[model samples]
Every structure is written in C-alpha cells, then in structure tokens.
Target: MRNRSHIHQLFEALAPKTEQKEKMLQNILVQSRNEKIRHRGFAPVKRLRSAVLAAVLMAGLTTTAFAAAYMGLDEAFLKFLNPVNHEQAQYLSNGAYVVDKQVTNENGTLTIKQVIGDSNLTYILMDFSAPEGTVLDAARYRFLDNDITTRQNFQSVGFKALDDGNRSDNKISLVMSVMTRNSIAGQKVHLRLKDLQAADPLPGIFETIIPGTWETEFKLDFKDYSTLYPVNQNITMYGYEAVLKSISVSPISITLKVDSSYLEEINEAAGELKEIGDNKHLDNFPITINYADGTSETTAIFSGLYLSEHISEQILMIKTFENVINDKEIASIVFFDKEIPIQTGR
Candidate 1:
C-alpha cells in the first residue's frame, strides 16, 4: 500500500470507464505483489482501455506497495536484469570482491556493491537509491577517469543500468563492464563519476534536477580462475565456412570467439547485405550455448559482431554467463539445434 494513492490516481487519470478501470486496477494489484509485475492469469483489456493505460503503465505506473522483490542485491539484480547469464551471478556470490559501501550526498546515495576482475574485463555492479520519483537515464550518465592519460592497458568501457522494471520509482541498479587489452590485476584505478543528473520532471507540472559527483579507487585481484577450452575447428553454416577459435570461461563471463574471414566471405557473396529491417548489424544466424547439465540459453542479447578492418578480422563474440561453471562442461555450440563440434587438433 506504499503508493496506493498514486496508483489510484494513475487509473483515475486514464480515460477508461470507471467500472472497467476499477476491474483492471483490481487485477493488476492481485497479480503484482511487492512491486513485481508479471502478465500472468490476467485477462487482456479491450484495445480502447489498453490504449488509455499504455502510456501510464510504461511511465512507471504500478499497482502499489513494495514487495520483497528487491530485498537483497542478488534478488534486486535478478528482478531487473534476467537476460544476464547466471554465471555472472554465481561469481558475484563466490569470488568477486564486494564492498557494500555507500556514499551519500545532497542528491542521494550511491553504493558499490560488487566487482569482478579478470584478464579481459573488469565488471562493477552498483545501486543508486534516491528520492522518490527520480529518473536516472543510464544513457545520459557518464563515467570519467582523469588519470586515464597516465594509465596503461585499460581502454573501452560500457554500462547497462536497469530500473527494476519500473517497480520501484526510487531505486536504480547499474552494471558496468570495462574491457582492457591486458590484465587490470594489481592496478589501483581511480574512477570518477561526472555529470550524474537525476531528474524528477512532470510534463506541464514541475521539474527538478539534482547533480552530484562520486569517486572511488579499487584494485583488481589477480588470479587464474578461468578455464580456456582450445577449440580450433572449422564448421559450415548457411553456405559459409567458419572457424571456432576458442571458448574462454571465467568468473566474469563466457566468451566465444569466431574468426571473421568466413563472415566477410559470406557477406561479400550475399551482395552488400544491407541491414535487415530493424535488425541492424546483427547476423540472422542463431547461436546457442549448450551445457552438459542439459540447460541452454539462446538470445542475441549475449552476442555481438566485431569487424576489424585493419586486421581484416571479423570476430563473432558471444557473451555468455559472467562466471564459470565448474560442474557443467560446454557440450557444443548449436546453430538451429545443429551441433558444431569443438575440434581439438591435438
């Protein structure tokens, strides 16, 4: 009943009939507990009613109350980011360096929850809890390191922030990955967060902006905790021949690297393969990861195509579980359920 008033107001503001609106509200409340909403066992509303409520629901509209959804760090992360592989979550629970410390300012509080470091990537997970009705658009948030000019090896950085599915209007979680040419182990890296702007704006109402700065220094723990499976094999798919370079399983991620020459050949033969409508820069081929435990995950969210013009290398990088699974050996890479053997020419 935390946001009972706001929830009721949201429905009242919609143009649906009073009776239909009440019924929808009742259903949403019954389905969503603790701010976690799932479309299950709920009847679809009429198109007209849905149209009236669509924008509001997308704008963080909810059925009220804070459920046990985001009670803990792991639970909170899972609630918002399910597309992330389970290995990363397992590593956070096992080997990652975690300091559940928080920094507070007039704007709000920021916490660095956990971190995973390896030879190839440095991953950091953090949470920001601010005043109610806050909007921290991850696209606008920036990361700054003033001493980067003095550092070595570390290069590009990327981040993904999720707002617990609009379940809670006050808290947001972020996962940031920094890729380096070499290991970041034993190096004290100073990271500066600049221009973190939190906005609470109501169109045609009132607007507010809170700006703040946060800084932190941490060192990567160096250890050989990953298993590198040597797989230099050639496989044919969709009239194209390619080589599976290797699969690297670490506490932070599962990376599958494929040579690019084959892709280039296929692309050239296909005749300037223009971006498929709305599916830009992605190969239509389906790639899946199968584990010995009989579990598999399929999605383009964990995959990327890297084309290096200088080296004429087109490496297909499939990003899987962030952590390594010791009990489950990778069975094979499957394309459309067809197994591609991991040939070791030993």
Candidate 2:
C-alpha cells in the first residue's frame, strides 16, 4: 500500500497543472480576440479622417489661386491708365492752330493766309500770337453769327506722268449758309452749291473719280454757345478754301487757306451723345463736307447711314484721343452703326 501511494504521487507531479493554470490561459486567449476586433473597428475611422483632411486642404489652395489672379488683372489695368511720358500731349497741342486775339481776328478778316502741308487741304490758323499781359476771354475762336453769301471752291490737280501728257484737274463748289446768333426757330436754312463732276480723263492713264453729292447740316446749340462764348463777347469766324497744286500718286501736296470769317466747327456731337447715354439717338448728327475746291459745307443728315459711318467715326476718334491723353491703350476701339458700348470710369 505504501508503494502504491508513492506511484500515485509521481503520476500527479508528471501530470499538467489544473484549475489556476486553466483560468490564466483562458484570460490570455480572450484578451487577444478583443485586441483584434478593436484594430478592425478603428481602420475605417482612420481612412475617413484622412479623406476629410485632404478635401479641406484642396479647397484652401483653390481660393488662394483665384485671389492671386484677380490682383494681377487689377495691376495690369492701372499701368495702361498712367503712361510714363508726355510726348503725345505735346504733339496734339503743337499741331493745333489757335485764333486767340482781337488784332489777329481783324487781320484775318482783311486777308486770309494759306497753311502748307502734305495735302492741299485748307485750315484756318488762328493768330493766337497776342502781346503779353493781354486778357483775352476764351483763347479760341468759334463760328458765330455772320453774313457771308459766297460759294467756296475746292480743286484737286493730279499728274499722270513726270512732265508728260497725263494731267487733269477736279473741281467742286460748296455754298455757305449764313450763321446767326439770333434764334431762327421754325425756319430752316439751306446751303446750295454747284454739282460735283468728275475730272477730265488724263491721256494714256486710267481716270480715278470720287462720286456722291456733298452736303452737310448746321444747327445752333444754345448751351454750347453760352458756355463757349458768353453774352456780349465779340468772336471772329473764318472761311476755309483749299487748292491742290502738283499732285502725284505718291506724296500728294496741297495748299489750304481760310477766309477771314470762317472757322472749322469742332465736333460737339460727341458731348451731346454722352449726355444722353444709352438712350441717345443719332438722327440729326452734323457733318462737314470737304469739296474738290478749297471750300467745305456743314450739313445735317438725319438718316441711319450718317450715324453708322460719319458720326461713328467721329465718336471713335474722340474716344481714342481721350484714352491716349490719359495714357491708356484700348486694344481696339470699334464703332458700329448700332449703339456704342457703355463707357465707365476713366
């Protein structure tokens, strides 16, 4: 029986430990399963967080780029408005002729002088050469009330060859209508001139001819008269006459002069257009017609054609002149027969 007990004790020592050891092993297995489930649940949350962060970063970058582009555009516009030099201003001023004094006005009335340039086109050069310390009101002369009924003539002489038989002259006459400061309401004045005819054919050369009847209309602007010439102020008007001397195909030359009582009417239609804005209409726009002779006629054509061609050109020229004066360059100033584009801040 003692030997049996000893064998039983040896078997117990060799056998695995039970109860407490079993409990520890079960606890370790449950912890490993819980850790694997927690890692699987957190994987989707980490991916979602990364995606949201990336989206926000992209939005911020896009906004920053747009702001930079806007700033660059503004800077470019400003540079065009302010030119760095003043050469253009001087050119326009020097080219213009001003009639500013009373004595020169009297001399112009007595005898007109011719202005020489590329074309025999005539322009009145106002004798603005006044003595120092003279206080002349309004240093420019505009057409005022005048009584002159003479038909002015313009002639263009062309040469077909150098000292050969190819020579011809074209002549046209335009009548002048009397201008008056006194209001002539309901009474229309008509300016009549000789019909324009083509020049005689030149021997051994093709004849070039310009067609269509030349006429223009004139109207009195009370506001412009009041602003430019105040009440009881004496101003002189001059008449223009042109004569084309030796005219070759290349480098044509002409001589022009103004009679004592005539002056080239400045285009005041542009001012009227601006005052009316988008609702403006161009039915009665004014035009100055240049004839083959040394004379021009002012008339008004209340048709759509005049608005599309002549008046439109005048508007574009004025706009371009203003932009250039302000040191700005518009890509291309186009004037259609229809309504002009709206103009904003200078």
Q: Which candidate's lDDT is highest?
A: 1
How far in Å is the alpha carbon of 29 misplaced in model 2? Answer: 99
State each model's C-alpha RMSD to the native: 18.0, 38.5
Per-residue accuracy of model 1 over 142-213 as CA lDDT, tens digit each: 333222221554365665565456643667777766665445655666766644443232222222345567
Candidate 2 segments whose C-alpha is farther than 4 A from its true place? 1-84, 89-141, 145-328, 334-346
Task: Using TM-score, give the best candidate's number.
Answer: 1
Writing each residue's lDDT as its tens digit, candidate 2 over 1-346 gives 1233443343344334797679877885786566556667687765675576568758867885544322221111112222223332222222322211122232122111111111211122211222333322321122222222223232221111111111222111111112122213222223222222223222222222222222223221111101011122122222122111111110111111112121223233233433233323442333332332334433232211111123222210111111122212211111112111212112
Please provide TM-scores, in order, for all candidate models, with all chains considered together: 0.52, 0.18
Cα lDDT, all candidates: 0.51, 0.25
